[model samples]
Target chain A: MDVKEDLYHALLMEYASGCLDEGQSLIIAAHMALSPAARKTVAQYESVGGAILDDCCGKVAMTKDALARVLDKIDCGDSPSPCVQKSKSTMAYMNAPNCLQTYVESATWTDGKGGYQTISVRTSCHRSKARIYKIDPDTVFRVNTRSPHQLTLVLEGSFHDGRAVYRRGDLIVTNGDAVLHSDAEQGCICAVAQPSVFSVKRFVQQIFIRY
Target chain B: MYITATAVKSLAPRAPHSVNKPMESGRAQPKTANTNVNGAHHKSLLLRVASKKDREAFAELFEYFAPRIKSFLMKGGSAPDLADELAQETMIAVWQKAESFNPAKANASTWIFTIARNKRIDHLRRVRPEIDPADPLLVEDDAISAPERMGQQQETEAMAEAIKGLPAEQADLLYKSFFEDKTHADIAKETKLPLGTVKSRIRIALEKLRADQKVKELWT
Candidate 1:
């Protein structure tokens, strides 16, 4: 591999291992957005890591209680009932630590429709935070955070955005604001770590609180 | 790519009758097939089984994965009983979240690894004073080196063999990079080499690892 490719791979290795600093991570993410070859190489490395992990646990057997618990949960049928309709206008909030005045408030909320839901954890002032979001089976959620750093970790289901398939547990961290299209088969569940919040009003207040 | 002379002797001898059966003969080629989608597929299947409350699948998956998780922990310097307990805890997470399995975003091992990795990290953070001190480098040496430990399964054993073939210096670098998570500069300082040379050697080692068919044998 050439110097650029090598650097890209090195960045990718660090990213995969969660060792990259914020600025370095952003650079790699931007490059990945523009370069298919780099993305593929990253995928290959991830594949290698995944494969090794599999071998380490070869034919992993779930514990005896593992299945029993699932069965029990299924028997309970724990999903929120249709009768308890979620209000469309209600927005929930989870405040951050008092010390984190400069950071955006982080919250996790589930909607009645389960279609439009988000788990956001960000600094109100600084542009660095982690958020996870999910859209129901047929709906889509749009984000327009014009920040210099963004990181996403998929928690469940899948979505297609640009060049890659965002599946369950896939970490897709990027920088800047971009259009996201996710009205696919499985919907989308993602954890987003970014420098900014989705709303400007919140951003202004965040700054005020910080100062 | 240099295999120690002794390592060549450790290969399991082939059966004479294996020559007649292509399937059996091919099986001797090393166990890389299951590492890709197969690993993920099995995980998805287990998740489905959990969602559907298929007791058999759940039991089988738990039986298989729990022990491996334990083994992984044990190798990482965790006491055997504690490793087993953590493995059980990981399985509990799997059971509780079985209904949420989504194969699109992550392969199975990645998902499981994320959970296990998170749990392990959390456990270490909770228990280790060094983590709170914020000096990761000082504590890195204490972390269990994944490559050094022999796994419970055949495929992992094969991978161990492949890793053994790498040059000692290259292997050490890879170990630090993967397990200790040391950067190129840190590795350079440790090895008394220039940063550029360390980077070059690491690049070359990874390339060689990626290209070797024999290296592929253990990943399944």
Candidate 2:
């Protein structure tokens, strides 16, 4: 009950509708890892999505030899994805969902000229960009961008986005540069998803971003 | 925290639904295949595929889910051929992850469709790196929880009915938001409604489903 109740609820609904960008979705993933209530609520939304999916009309069967092709593709029946393995190993501290963790591992993070580094993960299906960022303790960072909609989730430590304190499992969604200033209480990592048409810049005024 | 009375009231001046009313479905929705109300048979079929490496069982699953997946992807705006290809990949994922499916947590229909959703996203990332519009609707293997007998299933039925009961414009918004993969901002641009109104309408629709007394009753 003490959770970031309304915000996560809205985010969960966005997630249920499949409208969240990857950055926002990843935040939900980590937040769910921290909150069982969020997990249960999210599960319910998934069920809602499932219920609707069951009602889609115009069912079509697969192409010829589809079964044969799949059987051939399977590594003798069961194929364990590497992402699942990583999820298990990293569950303790990372607390990131397997899907996001898989992407984060492969993504190339760029060290900004401040106490922060970032990796733009995936460009969205609708021309947005999903980025992950790392910030150091006691550091203040600024993102000057024209993203109409953006989402931020803290994977480590804590920070305040001028308006509220966001911790390891909180998702902060904003409209138009809502998080112009972020002061980290400790080392922090965040994933941000936004429209790709606009460029983003982060600055710490004067601080070295340790690799 | 529960929906605040103020937020719920501001959402829609008129609370459109009286939750506990027995469902009066005007739409004669198609029953799922072979009268399998819960898709329990599909789960058993999946179990066989997992434990026995049953090819026949997988083939049956392929027939049932592949096309539906195709429909799902296509509805979300994938090209027909691409949708077909992703559908194939989704079924393959199901084949590979059959052992991971837990009927106690989800029915097969829910499980397969969830996988289908993820596969579609994976395909999008692989083919087009520049496209980054995130689709948040994801169901993962680790997410376990059956729909409350009084909650999800009843909510689904009520939602379908609710969609029917919605004002035509609001109903259209729901379809685009849920089925077409359209964002609220995008919907506002298309419908010429303000973004705030679009967000409010979609959020209100969801609140309607979540506010169902049957859901609260079940939980309580």
What TM-score is obtained for chain B in each of the predicted models?
0.51, 0.63
CAPRI tier of model 2: acceptable
Clashes of each: 27, 11
TM-score to true structure, per model: 0.43, 0.65
Where is model 2 more than 4 Å wrong at Cα?
A1-24, A56-145, A161-164, A177-191, A202-211, B1-36, B54-63, B78-82, B126-168, B215-220
Query: Superposing all C-alpha atoms, what RMSD in Å does each candidate have to the true structure?
Result: 16.2, 8.4
- Which regions in candidate 1 have their CA more than 4 angstroms from the true location? A2-4, A21-39, A56-211, B1-44, B50-53, B71-86, B96-106, B120-175, B180-198, B209-220
- Per-residue lDDT over B1-220 for candidate 1, one digit per residue giving the tens place of the 0 to 100 score: 4334243224312211121222221122234554433554566566676567666766666655665566545544567667766676676666666776644434555555545544564466421000111212111223222432222122232343454456655555554454343556566675556655666666776777666665443221
Interface RMSD after interface superposition, each candidate: 12.7, 7.8
DockQ-based CAPRI category assigned to the predicted complex of candidate 1: incorrect
Instruction: Report the number of the highest-TM-score candidate.
Output: 2
lDDT of residue B176 for candidate 2 = 64
